[model samples]
Target: MCGIVGILNRYEAQSSSLHTSLRCLHHRGPDDRGAWQDEYLQLGHTRLSILDLSPLGHQPMASEDGRYCISFNGEIYNYLELKQELTTLGHSFNGHSDTEVLLASFAQWSTACLDHLRGMFAFAIWDKETQNLFLGRDRFGEKPLYYWYDKEAFYFASELKALLPLLPTVPELDPVSIDLYFHYQYVPEPRTPLKGIHKLPAAHYLQISREDWKFTPQCYWSLENIPPVTGDPATLIRQELEKSIELVLRSDVPIGVALSGGIDSSAIAALAAPKYRDTLQTFSVGYPGRPAYDERNQAEALAKSLKLPFHDIELTTEALVDFFPSLVAAVDEPIADIAAYGHYSGMQLAASQGVKVMLSGVGGDELFWGYSWVARAARISELKDHYLQAPTWKAQGIRTLRKLAQHPLYQKLGQSKKVPIPIQSWFRPGIDLSQMTLSPPDRAVFYELSPDFVEALTYRPHLFTQSLWEHIPLDNPYCLFPLSPPTTLDIPNQISQTLFQTWLVSNCLSLGDRVSMACSIETRLPLLDKELAELVIGLRKNQPDHCLPAKAWLKSALKGILPNEVLDRPKRGFQPPVQEWMHAVVRENLETLTTGHLVELNILSKSFVQALRDEFSNKGRHTFMLYKAVVLEIWYRQIVLSSQSAVRI
Candidate 1:
């Protein structure tokens, strides 16, 4: 909902640098801006004005005794309840803004206050008395916080752009992060593309004290540690979702829903319609002439049944071409997914209508078993484990069949390769594992880059050398986190947790925040509410297989609330015409890389880049991979090379 930046300098801090950084984040909060400074620290805030629309709501707000001052981003949905409790404990406030309540809560309970919060947030609270700074992110990372630390100073910001200017020079490119970006389309958390910059991971907080000038990030919450709860899961899920939606509706500005034809959005719209009634608005997007990829009609019918207003936007090829660069800039990183364009357009439409907040249903699929591949993989993993526990001869026979099944010729014959039970396909995008060991059920989950590509990339005319690749261990990328392994839970639950922690948190949620804030509108995800997530996780543990029926429990819970047509329809994700759009975009920009910064830096081979563009134009087999390469090149030029004060790559 806003942008926040701060600097803790080892020497004198400048107000000019703080204001300049805030200018870069103006789009995130155009309503108001404020800065608080002292000898050793400075905090700046850009306000979006969703909660309290008065001068009293201004941030860099301080406690009554002037011992604590804070700058915060995101909504704390349960702020009213926290305020009521704090009132009983003798805390008073002049304004009803969540920011005031958050500062008071911290003053009362310190870092333990995080346990009571139930909404998305990333905030920093500075204690003048103790000379300590506390930084925290939401439980699921719905908001982002990036930081750079050194002996000279420590800098933090809501977005990476704000921190770049404070650096003495452009940070060096992190090759490991670059390789991770190529593998996952987006770099994983706790690491950014810049060598010294790091993202504070979800469910964690950092405490920096002036006593020693040392910072240590500690985890405050984790899905792996959630205690089991027993109940009528269907009813509990419905109640929790409604409760979350009601809290998310706490805003001074008009709110709307980003509805799709799918059950997730449809259910949210249905639940929210009665709360706002005729004032509620809904928005959807589709390709201009691609009916197969369009869901406007379906969304319109659902909106009509609820008697709510509906708006649809058509995305043409020309518009996509024009907005491509802006989209890359908004994303801040190269996210190869085309769905980001759809989200960007939808948010732009909503913002144009003067709406400030929009509710989405992003986490439903990850919470429930929405993706068939994940469910199938879980089942396959379970079956393989069961068979492997049999007698030695039986296990050996099964292993022989697994070897044959993994053969390149056999795998090619099948329409879809039966991914090794323990190896998640999502983590190994565009990777070939023929040379790796393939044992049943117990096959190592780690994977290496393809030998051919490695050989080619390590040859002359490349930015990366062979030694860098050799240094990266072939461990599963998921191992990057210290959380418990997915195998600790049931197969279905394991897959759900993996997707939620990695894909949903890193890719989907990051995209939602960036693109929506690009237009200065705030997005709320009801399905990812802390209470709702806890209920869903408890339900999965109680009935793992029962909960794996592609949102079957959710449909049953909302049987009367939503239209049967919407619930029964198969899941068709928001699919854009990426093949056609990418081909056109790539052909148009292909020549840029021939002499552009990426080739000039020797990170990429011009001939290889030419081959990729030509192949995509001729036959669109590697559309996303090629698109990712193009996006990386553009991002590198704009972010790293174009900065007047940046260091040369």
Candidate 2:
């Protein structure tokens, strides 16, 4: 895991700045740094040295003939296997690391080599012979890659912060993306909040030449559109999941697991515990006195069950407060998720203990429908459909039942609005619904009736109606059985994939990559393997809930390997009690930061900032949104606005 940057200029000029920009990413690769430049291409890289701890592994790695030089970031888990194939085909390796194997694999298979890779990666390979530069991102975007281009030149980097310095002018935010961020807390691809710069979507590649640059992002994977199949899903799931876990264990370095005590992480620990035994190390974190925020007990139980060495960090609000500014700076893009601090603090503790690589069960929920929002979304959509599709008498009966048992009916209906009027007002706009309750999307339909609109339609309730049908589709299973879920794509599947591809890339992965790299730690997510992701998407949709249970698949596969009790336990996400912590520790700093710089910039409203601060100080329920807004505001002042008036970092 490292950072890579490069510049391809239309007109020749000094690129010493590329060195400085790459240096900013020194936290990403404290072990080594390397740079190379020829006629048109200048590439820089920082190395964390996970695979080969030798100079040979140092990148800006060139082919033997010097025709191609590649500056790479990320691990290629299948490099050894690919190396064997290349060796038989007459290629000699100079090192044992995956880096050498990656260049050799490219030499042997070119872009087709990407098809055989089974890990997260982002790299820029320059071909002196073809005068072409190839930039690629991992299949699932576990690693981040961004680029900025104009007619004059093109610049690419491992993080947006590196590229920001090279720009000669201020980049404007895309209004559409700003709105998207407000709705989703992260902007979706291929859109960033900033105009001109874009996150290369997952499973995509781009090739640039002196003449013209072409981007071809092929979908190597997808989870939404799986073909129909028949089988005993439970057994199939068990076998396939085990195979996937077994494959990820092939690292050259000592492998460690991030045991959050959540079902997902616990399952990974359980599966690998038997083989690893004495060598296995498990880690978790909790606030010292805040048991509600701690998973140490659960983690200890799992460790005892597996007989693996367990390590836990008891964090204080004081420690978190000190870490906040540094953590914020590490995240080049502002994000609302405070859980990043927990992950950062956890990684710091783990790395300090001398663990090199750690595995996390990140994709477990996306694959297994673990989150409540996903299930709830399906239920509500189905209820709206049921309410709309019912006979007049049946609909009247439901309405009557609704009055007698509103709570149960609403729970069964799978939709909730504190006040139904807002639902009608937000969607129906100018229409009257005094005698009618329309499904959500129908409200949008009434206002904008385009002749061609099928492709744009989705089953989201917020866009259509506030009532049962506010966002539900008639064909949507969620609409039919609001309480009961559809076997088809429910909230769990769709939300997970959407968040994985978009929000995770734009926010979580981006933030994780930046913060972890900023501290010189190469964070790896074993559960996020692309083949595993595609496999989950390809599974039978009608599989019994046992096979596709909300995070239950992991436990079933681990079976006797992990303790049954730990496997059955609930998910404890990497959530630090930021609200409580901030009120206790950083309330003063929050005020100073927000009022002093953030408000002065006018990027965020002063009134909004103050309200958020007060609400957070008073222990209000909506403090999370306030935290998000203030953090973003501070980010705008520090990274965005500060760059405008001063010399670039």
Candidate 3:
């Protein structure tokens, strides 16, 4: 894994400045750096030396003719296999590395070369023969690519900050996106907090031609189009998932797992143990005194169950305070998810233990219906009929819904779904009798969709609106209702699919790729492996619990191999006690920075900052926003307000 930055300039410019931008990403690759320039294009690379640790593996790796050079920022886990295939077809290589395979693959196949790749990647290859620059991200977007385009040039980077300097104009902050940052905790793609820059979405690629100085992005893959599954495919899915996990674990370096004691991580660790059983090492992080949030015991138990060496890091706010200056600087974004504090610490701890690569169970939740919001929405939809009756019911409904909004998960769903009512207001609209338009089965399917999914996941608003219109005419069947609430497993499966293809790609996975790469860590996700994603995606949606609750399939698969106690436990993702930690390091710094900036420069409203902080300190609500505001303010002062160059590493 590494950081890559480049420019396709309209005006002819030297590649020297491009080298400066790549140098700013030195933390991503202190191991090796290279720059290649043509009359109209410049590409730069910062190497992490994951595979072949040789000068041959150093990029900008190029064709022998030097007409085609490339800079890449992620691993092609199947590169070794692809290399064998390419060699069979008479392509010889100088180095035993993925970079050479990639350069050769592109040279042989062009953009179609992506079809042969099966790992996380974001790379740019410039073809001097055609004066075309092609950039592609992995099918799952486990690696990030951000780009900015204008009349003079098109610039791209693994992080936004690296691209900020190439622009002739100062980066503009989009206030609307700031509102989204406040709503979602992290800004969603393809918009960044900056106005002009955009994240290249997963499953997509962009091509820029120097002749016309134009760029266009197109999708090369889609999970949405996977054909439906047939009966008795359970064993097939299990086999496929295991194959994917094995494929992704094929690294030469010492590899470890980030065990959270959850079903997902436990499954990966358990499966991987025998492969590296005696040598396997695991890492977990915890906040002392926060038992409600700590999963260290569960993690340790799993490690013991697998008989692997286990290590735990108990972090204090003080240790984290020392870590954040560089951590924050590394990410170069206001990552409002406080859990990243623990992830950053966990990576540091892993690095210290001499582990260079770490596998995580990140995409599992999105693949399975592990998040509470899915079930919560299901519960709310089930109860809507009971409450959509009397005038008094409506009023009471409003009151209950308002209280539900106070919960962070509900509030987040509220934002994602864009519920019409205030979070505090609970009253859902009573049934509309315009027309009982749909058949019973279809009507039931419509009702199974949560307000959150209806509001958030349905991209074709017109189709969604039409689906809702059909539901308006349903007869009140409360009096003669069946014992169960239409328990088709397919519903949650569809929801899981939506979460993976839409929200997970946009939110968590995207965040992981950018943040970890910014810190120069090559984070591997076992659950997002192409074969695994395809397997899970191909599962019958009708059996929502087919994977069972919290990776039931994983537990069952590892049943005899892993201790039953370890396999049967609940799922607990990396949750950090950031509310308390922020109070220690960020609170005072926030006050000092915001107040001093407001007083000295007289730019922002001091009263607004004070109110934001007061709310954060008193209620711990919107503290996420307060954190974001503080980070943004500090960044503005350092980059936009100060006269000093913002390109420092």
Candidate 4:
């Protein structure tokens, strides 16, 4: 896990800014830094030295012939295996580093090497032989790649700070994306808050060269393409998870687990503690005064039971408010998760303790049926499908005849009359009389914006300023998500797929990467392992026996591994005291209305700001909505307004 930046063309003009930008990512990789320049391209790398601590692990690493140079940012879990395969094919390496193995695999197979990789990665490989540049992201988007393009010049970076300096001019804020920020708490892929800048969607890749300056992104993998798994789900899930954990634990530096009170983190800690050679340290974050919000007590208990060293940090409301500004800077993306500061503070604590790599249990919830609302959504979406279907002609006609026969007037006066055709059905609207008009199901059934999207609808229109509305008259946020599922998937499986695409990829996974990297800590999520996700999802999709309630599969699988109490306890996720935290934070930062860029730029109106501020001061209504606006305002000031030099932070 490191930071990588590369320019396809115009190397001299961006050289100074490039170095400054790379320096800004010193936190991401402070061990060593390298810069490689060619007439056509310039590549920079900041090394964290996870796999090999020797100089041989240095990057912007080139092939033996110097034909292919790579600036890679993530670990390929199967690099050892790939290295052996490449060596058998007559390729040899000087050092025991994954970087060497990756460059060799690319040299031997080109983009086909992606098929052999099984890990989180966002890398840039420049081929001097063809003057081509290729960029790819991991399947679950555990790693992020942001890029900006033109006909001749192309730039890519792991984070926005480094990529911002390479742009010719600053891009304007995208209103549509900002609206989505309010709706989903983060901008969904492939649009960032800025237009023309994009996040390469998960499971996709892009490549360009001097001949074809413009290249379209291509999707290389998807869960829908894989066949379902058979047999006992618990056994299959456990086997796949163990394989991933074993491979993920192969790291040179010390590793720890982000232990939480919840089942997901406990399960990871339970599995990893036994496999590691030394005792693993566990970290957790909590709210000092808020009992409902803090779960460190339980987390500490789990650590004691596992016999691992434990550490924790308490984020007071004051600390949350004080770090709000830097949190936006660290996040880079204007996500509105209240617990983001917790991820940031926890990493700082871990880094101070000399923990380099951390394992987290992020994807466990999405793979299993963990979210209550998602389960409800699957059932509601099915009900909506039935509601939207139009009545057939035969069914409507039979109903009309029955109504007439039951009427008092028909029974008294026309009971003896033959009444060949029912009056209501005398005339057919369609010439063929069997014409059926179908109404497509509303996408809103499957789409939502958190806590309660339906409740949000009651006052959402009032929150957007009139001037902002005029600029984006056709901004329908629902269009950002998939409306229909393939015929092959069931409702629950399809809902899980959409969450993976939207909530997990764009919000949860993206936020996780930003916070961890901010403190120079690498977080590895084993549950997103290709084989593990495939097997669990495939089992849930096809097997009837696996159709249990939220997290039943995971609970059953870890019954013996984890304490029965740990597996059976209700899931209490990491949540902060939102009403108190946001109300206090927004009240103190209320001047965002007067001194903020959103107001100065006419993106937000004075009236709307005053109304939101009033609510925050009095009843604290729309706390989430108000907090979302405040985060955006701070982001604009801290990031965009200060973007004259991207490395200012």
Candidate 5:
């Protein structure tokens, strides 16, 4: 809901540089701006005025006893409850702002206060007495915090842009991070595209003492650590979801729902309608000519059924092309997902309607078994031990047959690919005997990076680079807290944890925050509430796989509350007309790619780039990859090369 930046220097705190960095974050918080500084530390805050809309709510707020000063971003939904508890402990506050409450709670509980928080947050508390700085990110990384540290100084900010200016020199590109980005479509947390800067992983905090200048990061929470809850999953899910929605609805500004026709959004709208009633509004977007990509009609129908105000935006091919550069800029990272455009445009429409905050159904798919890959993981888990124990020759023979079946000559001979006997199928699992089909992670390995590209760049790949294509053990789910998969969880739950922790946080939530904030709007995800996610994880433990269908538990929980039509509809993701858009964008920007910044950086080969365009034009099967390449090219020109050269595109 706001932007925060700070600098801890061994020499002196520079207020001028702090002001310049804050200017870059102005879009994140346009309501108010304030800065506080001492000899060694400088803290700056840009406020959006979500809760307490008064002068007393201003931050770099100091505690009552003046022992702690804090600059916080994001809402602490349970702040009222914390305040009440603190009051009994002899704490007093002048304002109703969550910032004041947060500072006081830290004063009372110190680092342990993080355990009591239940909402999304990324904040820094400065201790005057101890001269120690503590920085914390929310349990699920709903908010972002990045920091850069060296012997002489430490710099932290809510966004990467703010920290970029404070660095003494231009940051070098991290090759391993670039490789990870290409594989995952986003750089996972604890690592950013820049070499020295790092994101504070979710559910973790960092503390630095001025005395020794030692920095220590510790994990305060983990989904895997919670014990299973005893209850009917359907009932518990309903109760927790409603409670989370109520807390997420806490805001002083107008709020809306980004309702897609999918069950996730539909269910959210259903639950929220009775609470906000006439004041609630709904927004959806669709491709005008692409009916397959259109969901506005379905969204409109659902909104009409609920009698809520509905707004829809039409995205054209031309519009997507024009907005491509700006969209990449808004993301601040190269993300290949085309659906991000839909989110960006939808948020723009909502902002135009004067909505300052919007709730989205983002984590539903990750929490529940909504993806085909997740179900596939369950299938894989069942057969993993058997597959590994099988004879090596038998596995090789099966793999050979699969490749042979796909040969052009074999297909031309009018021979059908042999379906493996049912007895042999268990060894192959989801694999079709006729064609070589790799699992998602295996496919990632296959596409890791072409040796040709690596040689062309002349960059040595490290273990972090190699790990992108390798399988990681999921034993310690927290190993990849804001990044990878789990080890102890069941296969299906492991898949859920992997996707929710890594994909949801790095790709989905990052895009949501950037695009929404680009329009100066705040976006909330009720499904990602810490309590709701924990409850669902516990519920999944006792419930049979069949009992929990893809979001069926939610549908049953809201049985009569939501329309049957909305609840029964199949899952349709927010996909745009990417194939058409990518082809068109590539053709239009072909010239730029040949001479763009990526080529100058020696990261991309001209021949390879041309081949991608050629492949897109002739085969068009690698639309996603081609789009990712284009985005990276543009991003390099804007972010990397723009600083070193005078080029403008």
Candidate 6:
């Protein structure tokens, strides 16, 4: 809900340019600004007034004895409770702001304070007593923190834009990050477009001291390792989710929900409307003529049923064309999701209506098994293990029978004649006997038939210029599965872990934080509560959490809270008029790519640009690839090329 920056170096110079760098994140915090510094450390904050709207909430707040100074972003939803506990231990505060309470808790417990905290946060605490600086991010990465270090000093900020200005020099373009972006739509954690700039991984805290002048990050949480708790998962999910909603709703400003037709947002709206003291407003967006992508009707009906004020926006192709460049700028990172226009516009609508805080349901799919393809991928991994583990003649006979009788290639015979129930278990698991020779991760990528992902896999070979291709190591991004998914967990849970690390953090939550913060709207996701995630991970330990029907566990939690009309509705993405929007944006910007920074910098080949023009001109066969190219092109022009003479491959 705010922006925090730190300039901690071993320099004694004055005029740190701290204020100039903090102003770059003006949209993140428009309400108030503050700064505090000494010879070696400078801290700055821009406040959005989510809690304690009065001036009493001003930050870069320091302790009574002045041992520690804290500049923090995001809300500690459990701050009030922590304040009461701290009060009992003789700690007092002048204001009701969470920043004050967090500072007091750090004063009392020091680094151990992270154990008692429960919310999204990325903060820097400067300890004058020890001459050390500490950087901490939340368990689920709800808040973003980026930093870069040179031999002289360390710089950290809430956004990449803020940190980029203060760097010693423009860093080299990270070729590996670019290659991963084309495959996964966003670069994964610990890697950004620049080589030295890094994202502090979630559930991590780093400490750098003048004593050693070393910045070492220590991880505090992991989804891959957790003891399984034996219980009915449905009851636990409902209980924890309700508590999370209550916690996130503790804001002083007017609050609203990002309501959609789907069960995730609808469930939040249903549970939050009555609990909210005021009329809970809802916002949605859709394309005007595109009914397939529009959810206004269903969203409106839910808003009416809940007696909440409903506001909707209609995006024409022209508007999306105009929004493209701005989208690239607002989302400072190069994320290829065009659906960002919807989230950005929705928050703009909320901000226009005097709404400062909004709640979203982004982690529903990853928590419960919402993506059917991911579920099938889990089963396929299990099937691969079956093929490898059981190779006896009898087992091979059953496998061969399952392949012939249950595979889709042989499904025509089953339509007329009934297939046995046992054999049906093998149906539609995305199996490939001939192609199963590859490793588990590679095989999953090979069979993944999702729309953008299918083209995402093979585009790098044809798209990258020859020099750039050989210059960078284009390791096969087994993106369909995960980034080093753990083996101790079940296959389904491993898949969920993969999506959480790769897709959820890199794509869903990354865009969620950037786009929403761009509008200065504080969006809270109750579905992605940390406790709920740990519980679900435990449930998947002995049993397959996703092996049930798709999102069955989540639907069970929402059985009576939401109507069957929504509960039974199939899963949907934040879809837009993809083909129409693609044509509008790609055609308008084709010339830019042909003569643009990407080719001039020798990053992309001329042949690839011509192929892109050909695709958009005639039929637009590779639409996602074209969109990725445009995203990188505009992002390159604005973020990379515009930065002074960035080093290239």
**Candidate 6 accuracy as TM-score:** 0.93
Q: Local distance difference test, per candidate? A: 0.78, 0.66, 0.67, 0.78, 0.75, 0.80
Q: On residues 584-644, what C-alpha lDDT tens digit does candidate 3 reach at each position? A: 6666566675555433444334555566567766866544445655665655555444323
Best by TM-score: 6
Instruction: Kindly indicate the candidate among 3 and 5 with the higher lDDT.
Output: 5
Model 5 per-residue lDDT at 407:
60
Across 322-405, the per-residue lDDT of candidate 5 in tens digits comes to 988888877877777777888999999998999989999988887777764555545444344333445998677656665665
How would you encode candidate 6's per-residue C-alpha lDDT over 109-140 as one tens digit per residue?
98888888888899999999888998999887
Candidate 5 global TM-score: 0.86
lDDT of 4 by residue, 116-232 (tens): 999999898888888888898889999889999876578788888777877778789887887777778888888899878999899898988767586889998887787877888
| Top candidate, metric lDDT | 6
Estimate the lDDT of model 1: 0.78
* Better candidate number, 2 or 6, judged by TM-score: 6
TM-score of each: 0.89, 0.82, 0.79, 0.90, 0.86, 0.93
Q: Write the per-residue lDDT of candidate 1 for residues 1-649, one digit (tens) a residue.
A: 8999998876555444576678878989999999998877889999999998999999889888999999999999999999999999999999989999999989899999999998999999989888888999998999999999888678899987777876667787676776767667787787888899998989899999866888778999877677677888778988988999899989999898998899999999999999787567999998877999999999999999999989989998888888888788888766777788899999999998998999998988877778765555455544444554669887676666666666655555443446553354432311222222334235322222233233323332343445444545554333532222234565556656666666787789898999999999999999999998888887677777532458888888898899788888989977888778887667667778667765666555667677766776677645555666778887876656555453211
Q: C-alpha displacement of 569 in model 5, angstroms?
A: 1.0
Q: Write the per-residue lDDT of candidate 2 for residues 1-649, one digit (tens) a residue.
A: 8889988876664544676677667877878888898878889999888888878898889989898899999988777788898999999988888888988888888888888888889999998888788888886787878888887678888876677776777687554554344445556677775788887788888877776565555565566565544565456666666666676676555667878778778778777877777666888888877878788888888788788888878877777666676666678776766777777776777787776677777767655667644543443444445666789997787576545443444343333445474453343211212212344443211111211112123212222212323222344321211222234465335445554665457666776677667656666665676655555555535553422336665456567666667677666677688677645434635666456543453334555556556666676534444455555655666666765754552
lDDT of prediction 2: 0.66
lDDT at residue 359 of model 5 (Cα atoms): 91
- What number of clashing residue pairs does each candidate have, in the order they appear? 3, 21, 10, 0, 3, 0
Evaluation by TM-score, superior candidate among 1 and 5: 1
Name the runs in model 4 displaced over 4 angstroms.
10-17, 277-279, 389-444, 455-459, 465-467, 471-475, 485-488, 544-547, 645-649
lDDT of 3 at 267: 78
Candidate 5 stretches greater than 4 Å from native? 14-16, 389-487, 544-548, 617-622, 641-649
Error of 6 at 342 (Å): 0.8
Q: Per-candidate RMSD vs. true structure?
A: 5.1, 8.3, 9.7, 9.0, 5.9, 3.3
